[model samples]
Target: MSLGLAGVCLALVTAAGATSGSVVFVPVLSFTLAWTHSIEKVRWEEDYVVRPGKTPGAAPVLEAVAARVRGSGAGMEPPPDARLRHGWYEYTPTLRHPAELRLTRSGFTADYDWCTGGRCRSMAGLLPSNGGVTVLTACRSAPP
Candidate 1:
């Protein structure tokens, strides 16, 4: 079954790999000004994160979606910080349990280190097309 946009993986289908043939685009925030909190701090921010699986190599597709989402906001005035970002968006490969990755942009980037207990290392960095996810499982990496 489809989990819709459960957590950050968005609409990850119940299959893994780029070969799965059932790739799906998870939910993306169309509007900005969302609230976020963490040990670091809490505040409202403008950003959108696309939840893509961790199979790797899904960045291109996710980026395309992000462009569309950003495009929707075009013809209007950009926020003060829009100049610094490509599209106020990023792709989340996976969201660890209990250690939730909230709606904060920093949270997404920091989770890379926190979720891995600092031992987590990405050889190629956060791309997209992660291990397929189903209703039974959020986007999960094969347990080591």
Candidate 2:
């Protein structure tokens, strides 16, 4: 039984019968469509679930994220103000900048000032799903 990702989806679609089959097909198809996007260099899987107000990024998967960050964007370029605190990483792009990207074990936050005028404002939003990306390659066949 070659039950790979697509195979598993097909089996589910078949089991759903004709009436609600379209519903199942749509979501499975979306997963297939994910191939179009860039695969991040590193991967984070089986992320830990921390309680509200607790810090994130303490999972072992975070080691991969940290390693990927080191060699990335290397050069004479200035390094961002990066802090690993309470299991979350906060990166301020520059000094006195009204912007920061914070990645916790649970998710990420982007806060910044839109403008300096009297109407200037700041904004942030919580993530719907905190799961970080996991890069999947084509699974290889078992040795014959």
How does each model score on TM-score? Answer: 0.19, 0.15
Q: List runs of model 1 lying over 4 Å from the truth.
A: 6-28, 34-45, 56-144
Q: Write the per-residue lDDT of candidate 2 for residues 21-65, one digit (tens) a residue.
A: 211111111111101012333211111111111233221111111
Residue 43 error for model 2, in Å? Answer: 7.1
- The candidate maximizing TM-score is 1
Superposed Cα deviation of residue 138, candidate 1 (Å): 10
C-alpha lDDT values of all predictions: 0.29, 0.21
In model 2, the runs with Cα more than 4 Å from the true position are 1-49, 52-68, 74-79, 83-144
